[model samples]
Target chain A: MKEDPFAIKVENVSKKFSRNLRRSLFLGTLDLAKSFVNLPPDTTKLRKSEFWSLRNVSFEVKKGEIFGIIGENGSGKSTLLRLIAGIFPPDDGRIVVNGNVGSLIAVGAGFHPHMTGRENIFLNGTILGMSRSEIKAKFDDIVKFADIGDFLDAPVSTYSSGMKVRLGFSIAIHRVPEVLLVDEVLAVGDISFKRKCMERMEDIRKKTSIIFISHDMRQVERICNRVMVIDKGKELYTGETLNAIDFYYKHTIAKEVQNIDPKLIVYESTGDIYNITLNITNEKGENTEIFKHKEKIVFEFNFESRSEYQNPILGLDIVSPEGITITSLKNVIFGHQRPSIKVGHNNFRVILEDNSLMPGTYRIAFKWRKQDNFSLVSATGGRFAIQSEPELVPFGGYFKVKYKWIQN
Target chain B: MEYKTIYTPNQRFKVNIFKTWYIMFRNVYDYRELIFQLFKRDFLMTYKKSFLGIAWILITPLVGIVNWAFLNYTGVLDPGETTIPYPAYVLLSTSIWGLFMGFYVASSNTLNAGAGFIMQVKFPHEALLFKENFQHLVNFTISFVIIITTLMLFGVKFSFLSIFFPLTILPLFFLGSSIGLIVGVINIVAVDIGRVINKLMELLLYVTPVLFASNTENENLQIALKYNPLTYLLGVARDLLIEKNVQNLDIYLIISLVTFLIFLLALRLFYVSEDRVIEKMI
Candidate 1:
């Protein structure tokens, strides 16, 4: 059996952040009183108010592994990073790091505006645990990597945002700690610089363990050997990158669908009195088939009515898995009016031409009502998955348009 | 791989003062380059954007001297039995007092000002305080030079006592640093202390004999001033600069030794608590 290679072990870690200000104040007063009374500080008591940001977050990253933490905003991913970096001590539980750690939670965090870049370099390097001689040795490399040549001598306040970040990143990576904690800083640099930073991170990852927190799932998938999803401060899943991302999307989609009120369902009215059947159709008009990216699709609603309402309106909307309205279509643009349904059954079909959307699962939503008053009479929705043909196009999004290729 | 382990998994709490001191000193020495870097940055940045540039150092002490001269001329502060000119007296007192004030302010606010460094980076945070304190040392040195130059220009008598200026600042630095370390620690654990210290320092300026010489006849105030370490520091500076060799050497020696010990104790406490306290607060 292979031995576990993890250098850092976080066991049953839970962190709480109190949202209540009054509770915090009360607890602070009590702690003050206790200290004055010469009593030992009670570490376990929350006093009056506290909430856990992370609950039973347990995971292990082997030495020299690149681990990604993926979550939406307010997911407590950053809090975990801070805890591991020792910026904030854990309210409970233990995190044991076998070696030195470096964190770049925010670039240029300590750079004084009035001080020059060269001056800040020494300050920043020392803050990252580098001695003067060590910084001096790496001075040339830092300057070269920052690429802010003559501006290094100028005050850092004069440097642009990119320049400052570059200088900061250069110093941080040069520290060469055993563990590196990075938080969303990769998104700040330009394309070339970002690529360079990624390359540097890859090189560093071979020798150091890294915990990278990012919202960009693609980037996480690209570099991380493993991934963890945090939701509401709890570990939703942790495993391989692809599996974690798939679980995240599934969980998010289910949560969103459950949150939507079922009573908002719309139904056809003022038409032939017949049962309306809503069927999701692909670009080829095939039923029960997953749609392909950039393929034509349609929501064919079949109904029978005794009489048709004049100037009726029909609409369809496609919602992303995350509940964001991706696209909406209406019959008004097609120069079609809601024909009066005689006292019989009728069929209504809303066609979506050239659905040029990225390859992702989406939900089909339908709405129908009389043209006037526009009261939502009936609505029904269902999910659809779009599968991209990688052979036809590169493995990115589905909306690849025609363009002239020229070489000078 | 059979091995006999002497250390247990959960060890009892041990307080090793010598080991802690060793670690603190080693860390400071390792990061000493940062000290000079911060000092240079602070010293240069202060004068960089100013139109008057380095002249502000000279102008500051000059302002103190002029303020005292005007106050004395209007009989706001009675010139004591000492025959020293009021401007000279104020310059000597204010320059040394300025050093103490500068060190105190810098040290007191070191953690607050360097919170950016504390929260985002993993370094020995005490170095930030030391770096700020050292920068004030540089500023004091620069201001002292200006004071000495002005005295020479005014044709004030220069004697062997002038050599003691450096020695005088050593005791004053230790004294200021002790107060600063204590205040810095308190400010980190209890933020309200910072505001209170600032207000108290302002009030203390009047009570501390920075401008007027103490009259030996006023036994009560004199005794009270004697207990104030800052008074001893300022007096030593004045005696060395204005009174020449007529200063009391025995008093200076006793105060210096005592202040040094206090400073060492404060710094030791600061080092032990700096890492854990900063993490908790920020």
Candidate 2:
């Protein structure tokens, strides 16, 4: 039989956290009293305000794999990471990380403010499981990577929050721990530093197995060979990144999401426009709120015109989740400037081929205006999630562009 | 020691005293570097914010000794006659007693001092106790210098036996750590225990014969002093240094032995309850 190539293996792990202070006080004492005689807490069941933060969650990360954990706030993702890091012991079951485990759980958690940055490099590095010699070996590299030139000898209290994070991250990444547990601390670094960290992580990924817990779906999809989606301390899905993300969006957001207004979303200034309805569908004519890269999406709208006008501009705006408008489509830039239409209940369709919107939830803001006067009427409604193949989505741009490199 | 440690429930608490000591010793040895680094941080930190810096360590006791000497000189209180000068006697005794108090403070503050590291990092938390104790030792040595100065100025002579000070006061160190460990645990879960213990240690200080001679004329105070563990733990260490006769060796040995056992149990309790401490800290 082939040997299992797993770096961290968690089996039937569970942890309980008391919900309130009074309960924590009472139960903390009770547990301490129980432990005084070398006995364990009664983990088989819950008593009082205690609830399992993680319950019977099991998974394995193979050697040299970048595993991702995705979940909503208050889910057991952090608890599981803590358990595997041995920061918290499991209430039941086992966790076996074959080699030493390290974490970026909270960057610079061990830095003392009165101490100089050089001093903290030694202290925090040791606390993070680096020996003095290893720290000395990487001291110059750590300072260079942190890029806080003049402040290297100043007390860490003088460093800005970002500088501290950079220093902490710099100290953390120098060594290759067999299993590294990373939280969302990566989101703190600036663009260039973030890119450097990703590159460094890629370099380390050849030898290290990483457990990355992040809300940044793009990074998760880009780096993770496999992803696990969890909710309320239970596993929802655990396999391939794209499908896990799909399952996550379909479950978490789909449940409590408010339905879009079905009535005609029209403004008073939208002259000649009567009742209207917008529809987004896949090429097969089935309703879809999702589209993949290069997929075909048909935008259909039906409206009644009280009066006819020449060359009305049809507009559709796709806005990213961050509220920045990605693009706006105007009929003047594309198809016919004028189309023959009946005055009542006229339907029009626009097919958007080769959709290149990056992977994120985008809202559509629709507008219509007279081409002659240039005055506009606008209404925003409906949102859809677009997923792209992880490789094609380039950095530093919201919308992916269609381009080809020519080497002559 | 295994490189990999498995944590599980300690169900049906059985006191594994030997195993507990082994793990505690092994972990302390392994984390000596962290302990030293932490000690350095605290040693430099405690005096930084204060205007007087570490002079306050000497100032508090100096002021306390002066107040007591004035009371004794005015006949407001009879502390009985002492072999050495009155000020010197009180200074050395309280300083010796202060060692116990210092250890108690240091050990009690261990869990709170490392609260930040405890919540986020995974390491042996008990290693903090060593750092706390080490930092206190440096502070105590500073105070000890002042004690030597006070004794010299008062023309007090130390016996040849003063060299055994560390060994003589071993019980006080153990007693302080034991009491502090439990009190520290209590302070975490129930902070009010700290206030109660503070008042209680005040009462304990009066009965421990630190400020007065053990042979005070008052019968009630004498009886309280006789039963108090410090009557031997703190008294002998001071008595031996001041060239006084060792009193009640049997009781002293018994108290020292009892202190050793309590130290063992406290070590077990502290090592065992650390997980809960981590839980409460977070």
Candidate 3:
């Protein structure tokens, strides 16, 4: 038998949901009843209050590739993930997941709140499709990864939400299935733990293919090799991470949508902004995300606007991966000294010489302000990384400041 | 390690009938450990919170028997004479009935008992039924011991046929579970099914002549017992346990066959609707 290159193949998959609860149950049960006495369900049509949450969505994830699904809330991202997890059947089309699937959709899903954390590892591990011997072999790894020391004997009900997520993630990642479906679970835990999860994901990506669904573009760009943007249960674009993200902002946001109440703006104005993309370059002028210590780096922001303004202020913030703001840079506001932009495209640059950032991942957050009151019009873009060499400067801080004590 | 789950609607759902039927009993071998752990969790957690704890197993059946025994002695309820003493007779009968009810309750409440797991994780739902039975098995064993001791206290001698106690009662367990399994799925759609079944089980206990003699003086009660399949199962099992003249032995065998078939049909119903019911579980 020849093995397929794609780990997961979904063809013309669609799922319908009902807005009315009572009718949903009635029609759902009616479908079950129809299954009896040899009646086929009519998945092609819709009934009262019934609408397709996912429509004709098709995408293939290659082996060892991290695929991404990004959408606004209620845009059917979760429904897509759940459908792939085998939690529910797609109304039409076929989904072929090649191996055992591990779901991080709802971590600690199999956990009994009344049971101890130690007991839950065994319990949840089995539900995750691991054999008892497998669970026993990986028990220590799970505990250490969770890092919830001394709380192993305590009931899971006593655990904080973060603690539960940590233990749940620990149990799940250790199982290491052929395909893993992650749905916003990385957003829950604290920074260090989130970094640990991200690191673990990067490590496991070697053997396991992942389908990650998140609203965070930075996380998506940082992880996925390909992404699909879903809007109102429809696939607008699916391809390269940057292009899919750019496509998402171009189509999904309600720039023209108006709220029912006159007083409430559905969303704040983004300063006639279409969207933004970012990139970084080293002294050799070659683009790179990882940089050596004490290297000269340049930040580039490519902005697209619906209309242009003079003296528009563009701001940048260099943030640590731990979500801490290390520093902020802005243009002069007193004389309204700022870059002028045209209607179509504009570019800006900020330079940093002798960058002394130490051994960890960092992100650049871009903020665009109006020319008049300088209120934030929009905030878009997460690009650039100043990766540090952990092997060299193991104890390096955020930055190496040039200072010395004067005969103290 | 090599499992590919393909999810589809309609035709795939129909194909699953034969597929689920084939692997219904054979393929759950991997889930045995899960079943044991789930049973252990429920068993340990149950005993963890109470002062009297596991003793309630013995105490619940005994209390039920005493209530009828007191009624019989007070003459408020005149049940006919039994081959053994009244207390011994009622004890044996209700304990047998209790074991039968255990299967029904366990199988019927299978989905809801694992509500936490069911609402979240997707494993074999069949494992929950096995887990439920494990708890009932413990209760049945303790209750059976009490029944034997009560019979001894009354100085009733055991018949050699009593060796077949476990064997003879096997059909009753299946019969109870078969009915429960179908009702359990129905209960998911409308909880009224569960409530109605509970009331029906109580009514069934009286009509089956569990506490009273089968040859009761009341005409309506006698006819009810005569028509009830449990009368042959429960009565003949009790008879075979003590110095016995077992009646309805042939009907018991036929009923046992029918029970097995109904159980198969019930399992089919469960497999077909199991996924559908799970969709509505939340």
Candidate 4:
């Protein structure tokens, strides 16, 4: 065996599987008979109850690269990983793995319920390719990392699924493999353990190549050096992590935006009557309430007055889900270079060149408060949702800011 | 070991059979510690909740012998008279037959039992089969002690040839495992094959002379036993230790040759098609 620079190189790979047992057996018999005659079965032709899962996939990963694969369920991401892990042969093309691969594809697998957690550590570690002495040396560390405490002596069946996963994950990472295949196994652990796992993964990434598959876009963005987006068994994008995430958001999330009136959350009026309408246009110049992250959005308001009012303040407040007002605009709050407003009809346009709000629904409340302790009309205007591009911090509560960390 | 590029698609890449065998055995050798650990796990897990625990291995075979002895002693089921006592005859045969049967069952179910490990981990899948066989071998060793006690109770004189008794049974283990490996692979896709094999084992127990000596008066039954490999295997094991002479040495040697060939082919087939079989299993 010669030394190879690349850790993983998959070329024009494809996989096909049968849906049921009867057809699988029939196909097996046919393949066996054909093998006797030295005739290769044709992979291009599909028989009944068979379908191709991956088609013509090709990529190469450097020795220390942390590669990420992002796709929805049934997008063939797991199939691709399995092929690369040598779990099965591809129906067509070639996959070259130049180093030892340790997979965390299904955590806590092969754990016997009757065995103690301590015993299972050795069992699972050996399954992941750790030698006996290697496991013996790391036994205490594995227990400490898993944090099962005194329950380590207890049978694995007595432990919860989380505990089993913790033990399994600990043993898998401790193997110090050259190529690691992770498939959504980290999602099973708790928040603190997940953080610890992320740190451990980062440490390992400097020395080992990793192929990560996850639906958690934030996690992928945080650690992956490169990302590949797959949909329905086809490679949609493969390049820089940020660009692949953007490609995924534009196709899957951003395309779901609709041009509909935002729901009114709150409304109260005492005396004065006014009619209001809100409309938003996206960067594409099409009238849409949905806008991508940092995309320019034009918010237009059309209002009509039934009675003449004096010194009325027109205010707009954008409130996040936590009811915190992100930013508010009022004519009196800023230095006044006010536009004249007639009683019959008026149009006010606000163009936000960098609408940097995070990805979530936001309520836009409009209020017309009179000067000197009198209120005209205070009510919710409309709501428009933003679909931000994938970021490292998902579900961070709809607030995106610009800052960097500096340690003292 | 140096890093090498492993291609996925089945290609015209010629596999050196000798090299593949060497690598396969080398992997098994390297993972020997793992094999022992797995065997211990299976051994402990099988009797984990039971009060008897390890004693059950011996107790189970003892109960079988007692039940068969009672029937034979009552003359309700006459195993043709042997030079040795009937209880000793039944006891020895049952233990030997049980060992072979255990290998067959373990071999056939090893892959299915380790399906979870197969799907999630990348290790020598053959090691699991070896672990299963090892577990059964331990069980058989424990039960073999009861056979020795029965031999002394029947006042049977053992010859020096009894030292080779354990070595003789080794071929029978391989013969059962050869069939096990082939049937196990087939069972992964066609599960009914395993069920059929299980039923055939029951029928085979009656056909083989495990519970009785060969009755040449019944020509039809004798002819069937003559062709059955187990008949020659069990005959050699029993006569060498008890009767002090193997009746069918020529036939036993011929069967041993065939068993060795079958084992080689079975192992080759398993190693070659393991990945494809696992894909379907998934």
Candidate that scores best on DockQ: 2
| TM-scores of the candidates in the order shown | 0.76, 0.84, 0.77, 0.81
DockQ of each: 0.21, 0.42, 0.38, 0.40
Model 3 per-residue lDDT tens digits across residues A131-223:
988999999999999999999999998999999999999999998889999999898999999889989999999989999999776688779
Q: Which pairs of residues clash in candidate 2, taking residues 3 or more apart in a chain or in different chains? A: A37-B13, A37-B14, A39-B10, A39-B11, A39-B13, A40-B9, A40-B10, A40-B11
Native interface contacts retained, candidate 4: 0.60
After superposition, the stretches of candidate 2 with alpha carbons farther than 4 Å from their true spots are A1-4, A37-39, A255-317, A329-359, A364-408, B1-3, B11-16, B49-80, B217-223
Indicate the TM-score of model 4. Answer: 0.81
Better of 2 and 4 by DockQ: 2
DockQ of candidate 4 (2 decimals): 0.40
lDDT of 2 by residue, A56-109 (tens): 888999999999999988998988888888876778888888778888888887
Q: Rate the local accuracy (lDDT) of all candidates.
A: 0.70, 0.78, 0.77, 0.77
Model 4, position A290, has a per-residue lDDT of 65
Task: Output the better candidate (2/3) by lDDT.
Answer: 2
Q: Which residue segments of model 1 deviate by more than 4 Å?
A: A1-4, A14-16, A20-40, A114-123, A131-155, A254-313, A319-408, B1-15, B67-80, B216-223, B244-254, B272-282
- Candidates 1 and 3 compared: the better one by lDDT is 3
Sorted by TM-score (best first), the order is: 2, 4, 3, 1
- Candidate 1 per-residue lDDT over residues B1-282, each given as its tens digit: 211111111111133556756766776776677666666666777787889988887787677555755765676554556656666666677777878877788777667656666677655556667888787777677767766776677666656677767777778777777777767766655657657877887766665677567655577777777777677777777777667455566887898999888777766666544533454454
Root-mean-square deviation per candidate: 7.3, 4.8, 10.3, 6.4
- Report model 3's TM-score to 2 decimal places: 0.77
By summed lDDT, the worst window of 10 consecutive residues in model 4 chain A runs over A252-261
Tell me the docking grade of candidate 4.
acceptable
